[model samples]
Target chain A: MDKMNGAQLTIKLLERFGVDIIAGIPGGSNLPLYDALSHSTTIRHVLARHEQGAGFIAQGMARSSGRPAVCFATSGPGATNVMTALADAKLDSIPIICITGQVPQSLIGTDAFQEIDTYGMSIPITKHNFLVRSARELLEVIPAAFRIAGEGRPGPVLIDIPKDVQLEMIEFADWPAMPQRECVKHYRKQDILQAAAMINAAERPILYLGGGIRHGNAHDAAIRLAEKNNLPTTMTLLGLGSMPTNHPLALGMLGMHAARYTNLILEECDLLLVAGARFDDRATGKIAEFCPGAKVIHIDIDPGEINKLRTAHLQLVGDAGSVLAELLPQVESKNRQDWLNRMAFLKKENPFIMPGADDPCMPYGLIRQIAALADHETLIATDVGKHQMWVAQAYPFCRPRQLLTSGGLGTMGFGLPAAIGASLAHPQKTVVCFSGDGSILMNIQELATAVEQRANVKIFVLDNTSLGLVRQQQNLFFGKQYFASEYQHHVDFVTIARGFGMQAFALGASDDPVATLTKAMQTQGPCLVHVPIGRNEEVYPMVPPGAANKEMIGGENHASA
Target chain B: MQALKESYPCPPSDASGQKVLELTVNNHPGVMSHICGLFSRRAFNMEGILCMPIGDGKLSRIWIQIAGNSHLDQIVKQLEKLEDVRSAVLHPAEHEVFAKLEEYFQGS
Candidate 1:
């Protein structure tokens, strides 16, 4: 017979499930869990400054490794602090397991210190949640949490264990075996053949890829299908790295902030072969007019997502990779030279123009220089705002799991900590976080955590001295009444990084900006590079909110009006 | 509290324009909350609800009467995604589950 407390059992189960790193903070309610975790030799706990940082750090690990990662938080404030990250993960469909320590059973609803209804609060945000009543329930709940987090349509799962339950003793004869990933390959053959027929018959087809492509690990299959069918492909922000940005058929990101040519190509397509991508409003501006003339064939694991946004003519409910693999055989090899020629014409006419791409000091120019210096294997993470959009536009991401950003939640302060988590997951590879002034400050405390772990994360702060995206929105739509968007005073991120015991450099302060950036990138540990950006610089070819994809605002071709 | 209660009046329990969803779910403390939370968060109006344990108390059958609209399909789809919910079957307004319980709520 085996004997252990719930806390010990939980830690043991996590070790069995191959969880090596856990990011979290310890508090009164979760002391027993910390005590049990202390004895674990294999599981390394990363102490984050805030629970939110820990949550995002775990997100970083999960997003980079394509595995379910774990995080811990105490009850009440700790739990609340981590809620944002949980919601963020839920929206993006990232599999992450959060184990929170709750107040004892007796104190749960008695208005006790550090008591909150963690279970009730997490129900909406998590894919599945558990409130352990006894130590014995730990065995079933822990494995179930892992299963639910990683199963079909992966998402965040929460397990709130009361303190008394954590300390309760349980004796059992055997440990539960780890559950195998249930790969449901049950898709209709008729649907697949019909989708293939639609693709074969269509003269102009565009493959619209999203985060689901990365989640299903269908990058190679998607690329193959695109190339074989001679389909022009446009990716959503989350699906940036599915196809190499430099590929001939790659139209880059579509919808809002997309290149004029890409959105225009989408407008002209007769068929949209959507793989693992939901038609998010940002990706499909003015849904009725998104692809007005195109027939859609959407293949996703989640049945609910099929007709959730824009209804598909053919819905192939199965894993994206599996569906694509099946559809590949039925699809005929054809060179649609007419469509390609038209796309090339649009590209030549309405190209994505970087205004100051040649200068190393400009926003687009700096992103290009960084991309040039960084190796192909380097993982890029971005915080939300104009800088994130710029990186998504300019960065040449080549493979799946290459770029990690908060696509669904659009959370600020995600880049630095997420980059740290990625660096921890892959210690040998370089992790770069492209952040902006407004976004970086939201979780700047994590700089200390990055330094302490020596996570080898290079953070580049694109300092526009404002919430640039919000300011740009006010500029375009709100009559340029920038209220509460611009910062009155500037923050010196260089000195702040140095304060956190990190190597810091300022590109604006240096005579040779390239050398400064190179030195920062070459640094062996976590470093920060602050690049000053013009406040008025706006992301061009923006589809105004609620506007049609074809109705673009600013770009090279539309510079006058 | 009185003003708050007055501001949020009880939903009309009329069978007209109502759709019934029969859900088979795991019997647990938070299972009801999970179902109701989905409806509330999605802004779908629920008119009536009835739940009872089936057979061995391990599973429960919940009947939710919601206002029938274009969003009913979406509501059913979202309910099917819930982990605790085993199956969510939508029925037309004339479904007898909530109709049979109308007598209990008539004058209470």
Candidate 2:
């Protein structure tokens, strides 16, 4: 057995677990771990300006790659700064292992400098967290952290290592083998047959895809089930890329801000086959009226989600792909011309169109331009608020794992760092981050990291001079009481990007939008495009809280002729 | 650890109003955090918690007491699928394990 310090052991174990890249910052308490990380040959570290940026960057890699990613931070403020990301990961079920440095064990309770009870603070946010008590525990804890982060219902895991622990010497023995996750049990054939029987009997059925489909990489299976059963499909926000957006069977998203047509079709469906999605409030408005007449067959890997929100007539607890594969074999083919015709007629009557056509200076037009420019392989990540909803409603997503954004958490400041992480993970591909002026400033320091890494990321900042979504809400709900949504001063984003050592282009009212945007997109390494737009630009097709999906306001109604 | 367990007195329970959740999980660091975090995230509070390493130190058993509610069953199902949790069973609130412990403490 070779003798090594605790920090050395931790890094070696992380390497043994196949951790190729880690995002974080160095602090006083965690210097030792950083030292070890610097010495390691297998693991490359990306230095993030803020601990939160590091956390989101790791999230991007984990979410896009379908593998657990790693991040690092120091004690106290570092740990607290990373907390939001931990909660975000927990909400979205993204797998990430976060390692934070702590004060020496002896000073933990003495109110030492840079000391925080990270383990205690993290208890409510992470799937699990550890305060390392001994060097030997790393042999078990490191492997367990990876296992817990990647296993059933993946989420963030934290390991807080004290400085002394990092310095302590231990005999290094053989590392543990990668732990195997317990296999989810296959659904009973009888249950699958029963579900198939319901599917065959129903005249109008809709397949509902959720985030779990992306998590399980079951998009193919979901598409297959829809095609084989002759079912039209609707997606939850996180399930956007499970099938091509333009597929005739695709009814787009349902629920709040859903297409008027999609909601109407859902209202008329007889069978609602929920695949890997929890019926969240945002996706199921006025729960009682959502798919009112439809009998639900909920399939998900998490048993709790099966009947927690809306009761399912048939609950199938297993991997989404496995369950769908099983049901596919038993499903009988059918043709429902009446249902198809109804959907077509409804779509024609209530076309889901937004403003900004032929005007690249406008919000919707800019999104369309970005979509048109984006290669089929390009990945898009968005910040929270109106931009997120607009991208979800407008972007043409043809594959899973392509759009990495915070869904359940609705986290702002998720775009730049996540795109940096995605860019790092896939250096060959282009990664675009769509952020608003308000959301972009939340963690703008990450632009430095992107420039340092020379990450192939294109950042497009939609500057509306206000929190556009909040202003819209106030306008409609609060009698146009704008409040503090608007910014008082002009911020030159191009100067800020250049200050971070990245090339930037500022597109103002007089500039030709297409040429400037195209130049920014085609530039090598990291670049930022700043576009100034009107503060009154609202994401339309708005649904008031608790309102039924059919009660949509704005969008095509407010479109300028 | 045993002394710490005894310091906190167990609250009384009524069968109709209370619920008991017994879980068996692989014994390892952070398992407790994972279990407790789930309930906290759901905004549910545990009336009492009892945990100890079981058998050969490879696993442990935990019992959590929470108020009975319409969402209890769904929460139990979620607990059963937690990363290292091998099993999660909802015991009758009248189960005397904690009650017996409380009785012993009072006698002593």
Candidate 3:
């Protein structure tokens, strides 16, 4: 501990923040963190095959654990490779602390080898990025990175430490906290009042929640407000766990891949209250055409999000929980019979669709049954794939932050690490991660990180033996040519799971997969459930990237667009 | 009256499309929304813009593409006077591939 380098000091601080494992790739720049990591018994670094995988694993861990997870890589290419995952963290509002080593402070502006403007490159995707110009600055920057990453409206924060600074001897001073400038703009009383009155008066009020609900820790207040107002609700993909899925008012999801009823009701509604959810291009089909008849009320902790999109008639910029708490008192309870009746009618028509197969193994059935059997407070982290979509459509999540998935960046390998983080954050709660075989392969090495860190995570691999999402796209858009999407040689995922000293279960283990999942959900430690699904499993109701919501493909009928 | 006389001729409708946005970004907020907002609402071809830091903090200088000389001139003047604005200048995009995306939007 005495006279440690900047990397060593920073790693020790991270240990204090409960980081037992770090996913990273070492290079000339981050060689110090890797070097310091060898001498320290508290931190273990897991080397990823790719920087993107490393970044995603960290994102996964942060999302599941509800704590800022750490990742590292060298300058330039390594940093560039991780940009997609970092961007995913930014959009989904995950607390990921990404550290990359720069060439050197003196050589920063120069066209030195492997040097790029990483801080600037990451600015668009990070909650805050710091260029540690001085070695001493790490003391302040490291802790601030954690705070900014985990605080209100959580998102990834990047810290770019120069190689020289990492090696340089630095004196330690107590870390400083970021000064809170009295936000020149807070939600005005009139704005809050106007929003409440509108909500109370509206006949068809629908609450479209987003990841910010969980990020801001506004779950309790949101639940109360929703319940008190008897408001029907729908969430964006990132907003899945904002409220219980089985809650009478829950519309599951409300965008491209959303439930049919949710889409129908949202389109017909007269009043929409957007809480902590931005009308992203992904969520809002076409901006001009989205919710045309509705009056939107935007409430957010960050003012920048207000009126930045699908324009709101009443904008309330303040703490989501605080504003809701104040506005709840001003609200009057009312019912929208026509809206409720239409949602009921549409819900019956848009019931959860399941994959049809002759094989006994069913991923959708298993996820739904497992969700019902699992504890109500359990956390379910998911990777990007077709099975991930099945779980999203099937899983009955009851609590905020219970259903975790990467929305904005849609990183494939996010499940396992995120589940680790969630388990670490809430040890008492059961943590289940649903991943695709292709997705798991992206960062499967993190199983060792989970085992070493004593982070108990249950990983459910929907092994359709293919790049499910891509194959679905190929099937739909690319004329079903079926190029390279298939995983021709199935690597023994069970063996890989056992190699990490995890309890591995196969769907074919017994006559029933639901039993295996139920047992795994009941047990502790990182478990892997290799779910045997069909190779051609396609995610239904998909909004083909830039296509409008009404132009949904698949799910309703398999005849292809 | 003198300024009006000096200004370039423009349709009243085209004038509404020429506007400036002075934003105080959260050190973390992405500018994609701001960019999209301008493009979607203006629905017109844009000229050029500049962005730089005005302060030691997260406050960034984001200058966007404007169309029509007289309209562009008025926007620059008005935007510079916005409270959060440290300084403003009209930066016309000169020889950039993105200039096409601007051209497609600028029917006005």
Candidate 4:
């Protein structure tokens, strides 16, 4: 027989689950858990400055590696602090397991110190949650948490263990069995055939991909289906890396901030074959008018999402990879010459134009330069705001998992820590974070964590001295009443990085800005490069908040044919 | 109120306008909250709820009364997605479980 406390058993199970690195902060309620983690030789614990940073760091690993990652936090404030990351993960459908410490079971309603109803708070956000009543429950809860997180329609799962439960002892003859991966559920052959027939019959069909393409590892299949049918493809922000941005049929992102040609092309499409994508408002833009004339065929694993927003004429419920693979052989190959010609014409007439793309000082120029400096294998993470949209618009993401951003939550302070987590997961590969001045300050304390771990992350702080996206919104929608958006004073990010014992550089003060950026990228460990940007720089071809996708306002540099 | 009713027509008062959802769920402390939270977050209305442990007490059967609106299908699909909810079946509003209990609310 084997014997161990709940904390020790939890650590043992994590080791068995092959978790090598964990990011978290230890506090009074969780000291026993940390004590057990200290004895683990295979597991390395990374101390994050804040629970939110810890959660995002785990998110970074999960998003880049396409695996369920884990994080830890104590009860009360620690649990509450990590709520944003949990919400972010929930929205984006990233699989991450968060374990938190609660007050002892005896103090259930006594208003104990460091106590909170973590379970109640997390119920709405987590895919599944557990509150362990005894040490014996750990054997079941730990494995269940991991399984639920990585199951179909991946999402965050939370487990809150009280301090007494962590201290409880249990003995068993054997450890519980490891959970087997659930097999991909196949859809009916009739459904696949019906979908194929619709694809073959449509004259102007557009393949719409979303984050599920990456989560289901359906990138290759999605591309094959698009290429086989000669269909123009557009992606949501979360689905950016599913197809190479430069592919001939690729229309890049669609809806708000989409290229003029992309949204205009969608307006004319006779059919929309949406795969692994929920019709989010940001991607659809004025749902009633979105693809008004097109017949939608939504293929999603979640049945609820199939008709949640825009009703689909045809719905295929199954894993995206499996559905696409099954449907590919049945689809008739078509060149659709007239539709292709029309798309090419739209591309020629309403091409995406970056005003200052040639100069590294501009947002697009800086993103392009960074893309040039970094290899295709380098993963990119972006903080929320203008920089994020710019990177999404300009970055040449060529494969699945290439770019990680808070697409659903649009949360600030996500870039730096996520980059660190990605770097830690793939130590040999480089991870670049594109962050704005307003977003970077939200979790700037993680610089110390990056330095301590020597994570291979290059952070580019696009310093506009304001929340550029908010300011732009104010200018466009709020009658230019920019309040609480711009900072009166700028922060010295270079000095801050140095203080955290890492290399730092400033692009504005450099004799050669390109050389300074190159040096920063070439740095062996984590480093920060501050690049000054104009406050007026805004993302263009924007579909106003409540407007139709066809009513794009900007990006009209090229002359009409 | 008249203008509001004119713009958004109310459902018929007949029994055909309502539904009773029978859910078989794991009996646990927060299973009810998980099920109800889904409705609240999605803005789906649940007019009434009744739950009790069944069989060996490891599971519970819940009966929910709801309007037969456009969101009914979505509600059932979402309920089936929850970890604790094993099965969800929709029946006509005449389901005996809630119909027999109507007498308990008589001017109390």
Answer with 3 or 4, whichever has the higher lDDT: 4
Q: Which 10-residue window of candidate 2 chain A scores lowest in summed lDDT?
A: A552-561
Candidate 1 residue B72 Cα shift, in angstroms, is: 3.1
Q: Residue-wise lDDT of candidate 3 within A1-561, one digit each (tens)?
A: 256678887777787767887888899888987888788787767666678767876775677556678889899999998888888888787889899999978888898999988877876677667788777778777877776676656788888899888888876545445433232235668887888889988888888888777766677777778888878888887778778887888888877677666776777788999888988887888777777689999887654466656667887766677777888888876666677788898777765456643233677666766667777777788888777777777777777767778777777787776676666556777777888889898778778867765666788788888898888888888999889999889988988888988888887777766567677776667778787878766777787777666667756733321
Q: What is the TM-score ranking, best to worst?
A: 4, 1, 2, 3
Candidate 1 wrongly placed segments (more than 4 Å)? A558-561, B1-17
C-alpha RMSD for every candidate = 5.1, 4.5, 7.6, 4.7
Put down candidate 4 lDDT per residue, A1-561, tens digits, no spaces. Answer: 889999999999999999999999999888999999999999999999999999999999999998899999999999999999999999999999999999999997788998889999999898889999999989888988888888788999999999999999899787877676575453579989999999999999999999999988999999999999998999999999888999999999998999999998998989999988998888889999998889999888776787888989998887899999998999988999999999999888888998788888889999999999999899999999999999999999999899999999999999999999999899999999999999999999999999999999999999999999889889898999999998998789999889999899989999988898899889999999999998888889788998888888878865553
CAPRI quality of model 1: acceptable
DockQ of 1: 0.32
Q: So what's the TM-score on candidate 4? A: 0.97
For model 3, the docking class works out as incorrect
Instruction: Provide per-model DockQ scores.
Output: 0.32, 0.27, 0.06, 0.31
lDDT of 3 at B47: 52
> Which tens-of-lDDT digit does each residue in B1-62 have in candidate 2?
00001111223445357777778887976688778877877776687889999999999999
Instruction: Name the docking class for model 4.
Output: acceptable
Which has the higher lDDT value, candidate number 2 or candidate number 3?
Answer: 2
Candidate 4 residue lDDT tens string, B1-108:
000000112233454477777888899999989999998998989999999999999999999988776377677777877888887777744578877997996794
Scored by CA lDDT, what does every candidate get?
A: 0.90, 0.85, 0.72, 0.90
